[model samples]
Target chain A: MSLYYVQKFIYNINRDTKLQTGFAANADMILANYDLTDEEACALREADIGLLYVMGVNGQLLMHYAAYRGLAWDDYIQAMKDGLAKYGEVRAGSYVTIDGGAGGAV
Target chain B: MSLVFAGLCSHAPGITARAERAPAELREPFFANFNIMRQQLEAAKPDALIVIAAEHFANFFMDNMPAYAMGAAPYYEGPIEDPDWLKIKRRKIPGNANLSFRLIKTIMQDIDLAYSEEWKCDHGIMVPLHFLTPNYDIDIIPVNINCQTAPFTPLKRAWAFGKALRKACDFVDERIAIVATGGISHWPATPNSGKINEAWDRDFLDKFARNDKTALLAYNDEAVYADAGQGGAEIRTFIALAGAVEGRKINIAFYAPIPIYAVGCTIAMVDLDES
Candidate 1:
């Protein structure tokens, strides 16, 4: 799963503006350093919030990453919804889409 | 001097970021209560404020997470999330290294912990500070209970940490104030954001208000995850608040489900006895 490294990359990039600058320019270069599986690498490279979420990225890290990527709050929620529909469910980690996010969310 | 004030409040970033999105009826009243806590906190004239928060990877991360941590620094900076996104401007927050060191030394006597010279206050600390210490006049001492990572702090240990904190506050010369911030039940930052479990929240908060240590510590993580969602695990911060004021009843200033804010919004304070 390499979820730890995925979260670590997000954690580091979230705080380190210099790393973020590099990431903005060449995601492949940044993605290559982390030991991510092919799926993890693809999701991150595409800035695919939903897939990363489906891969079990903690929303704490994922939300910030989504914001850093210029996705607004509403967009961030929508991406996760799209992700739940596309990928089916959260694969790992603490976050999950309850009832396919069809209920309870305001 | 011992503790001059003690309180608990919510720290959802949305409280500031999405201020206009939530219904004014719920958001305004919740804010008024927070302002009430602030007025009361200022009246205590505390020398420093110790914030016990469940920081979301703002400072410590899973790479090497500590069960508990305290900040010992002359000054700290934060709202590590982009100022624009969080809607809380980034700034250098004041802190007291000397007071923090003294408190940490005593707290460590009872509980092992990591102390950091540098800390980035995420929504966890900044959101509370935004309401309670809007002026940033009081020196801050940030304390963190790891609520995000797994193998979380045991309920009993969290209570013990609170007891140790109370003892340390008593031992210090300054008129200290402690506030633990976290939600009782809700899913934050997920697809199911804005989901509110009012029944679960009231049941938990009731145990908290009474300082029912037995009932409070009885919560199992597995069950908490099932009923309260992963974010429910943040109860450790609230449980610690309960322990800090053990045997005393807390006056809840406010509690309601603000779905758009994404948690059972809460504000409360312990009525400390000063002789």
Candidate 2:
């Protein structure tokens, strides 16, 4: 498994009910007030975080493009997993570990 | 042999002349920056320019993608955007097929890289082209980097590739300017839209101005991502420029954080004549 890091995570507390109330809530429930940096924000925006969970490019690049276009973190994660499930496993590299918070598969 | 000058061009609405329709405050800074860039281009007077920019999802997608791609044909067409707002018309470019083919061959030989010749001009390229050559008749060699995908080229590798590109250009017989277009920081979409990392952007600017390739290459993907933002992947283009110059001091022309688009709009011109 290749590891990817999420630079930041932003949630629309109101508009994205599923994300804010779901993944954001889960993250806050566990990590509580995780002060994300601009880098983390960028990673989250690029959806590099999903790179940790998926393999090959279809899963990784698609998630990244979604994030770049401003998809919510929770939604992006779910979308990635769904895409992977349909597309199949990404080609494996060296098993890697990303040093970031706990995140769910898309 | 050809002389090559290389640097970065941030492709924002402002730089593309679309900013005239924006607020005065926004338009003012953009125009000011444009005037400065114009002077730099005049100083370079390149017969042709090799632009390195990222393609939006339009060209490459999840199904199939090449890590790097080059334009080898004699002409390219710009997207049909606001024709009135567009400052330039689609025109033929002077393409050095021999130089382009050679560069591709050398890059492949030196590294495990994949590229394509069948791609069209996107905003990443057209925005700068509009400014650098309003008529779009001047010749340009276009190279597209796959910044959108993973297994991304490390900053150091990108720089090394730029050096290889310079060597390839030397094998030709024309004057060329290289422009790397992209960003400092931007969160393209979301309610948290106007996010601008000025602090991180300044740090990059400082490092670039100092011509610190060692420091730049040393930066891991995380550090750059942290400092530059998700769009920060574009920083590779700048590093490539640094490699082409090879220790020359960068003559930064303009830098502005356009918060509306969540992008750090910047432009830097380097003097390659010294080499």
Candidate 3:
């Protein structure tokens, strides 16, 4: 849904280590700052790499978050592939296509 | 003319963060070319290096993304990704604010260029610097193209920006080297993360080497997405380099489909002294 806020949160965290620390300390408090739906908020709290990819979070931003959550390089790539298989095609944002069909998804 | 060197190269974080995982046969030569480039760049003896990179969301976001932004700071720190994640330590890199101001002012004559005193170096930049300016000795002036978001700067504008940058470098007295860094055809950090289009990458590289402005500017987003993946949109950086060097063909020291690196890894340059 609120893909912009989802991407925005990670973008902010990616740039500001203080914000990253803040999110780690009190995720609920940080969640309140963004106008995010429950699913978006849950995804952030759970460090749900799959759902985040399904929502089309910019891969550049999302990958760092995956690292922050301790997913290794290969695991991170696999998380996205798994997300694609489970959630179907990315619903919005740049990676919306399935495979070469839209390939923004792959 | 102060523009002493110009070239394009790939900057996937995997080059360092996941180094040992890739086949040595491929990785070694790719790294060798980087060493070759660094030696060539040092031989030029530039006081400053202008990095034209396609920044991932390390600085500007969709809220206020500039089509193009340049660094006008005295110094900067980054590898903004975790130092461990990028395999590059976080440290201050030298910059030339005065040189940047002059180049920016000169560029503004023909382009509405945006600038920053506070710029962060993402993997798009850190990866190349790890190879090209390992000591972090030369001052840097980073220019970022908005290759990430939609409604991106048109390919023509990117070329024009390059032309303007060349003029700026020429107008200045300090020896300046420029390396435009970005992936050619890749799906970086995505479900199809390691996907690469060797054919598309080679074709584009051929057009770039020829400095075929018409052919270079002919690519559109849809085809790029289908064949090159979204990261492929970064040809703007290469096109900008082509624009910088004018019509001269670049000598590609290295080129290969390094899929684990998620790009047609390349190290190429044009020596201004010869041109």
Highest lDDT: give the candidate number: 1
Q: Which stretches of candidate 1 lie over 4 Å from their true place?
A: none
Per-candidate TM-scores read 0.97, 0.66, 0.96
lDDT of 3: 0.87
Docking class for model 3 is acceptable
Worst 10 residues of 1 chain B by lDDT: B266-275
Error of 3 at A33 (Å): 0.8
DockQ, in order, for the candidates? 0.65, 0.03, 0.46
Model 3 interface RMSD over true interface Cα atoms: 4.1
Question: Which residue pairs show backbone clashes in model 1?
Answer: none
Per-model interface RMSD values are 1.6, 12.8, 4.1
Which candidate order results from sorting by lDDT in descending order? 1, 3, 2
Best by DockQ: 1
Query: TM-score (0 to 1) for chain A, all models?
Result: 0.91, 0.30, 0.86
| Tens-digit per-residue lDDT, B244-273, candidate 1 | 888889888899988778888999999887
- Higher-scoring candidate on lDDT, 1 or 3: 1
lDDT score, candidate 1, position B88: 86
Q: Please tell me which model should have the higher TM-score, number 1 or number 2.
A: 1
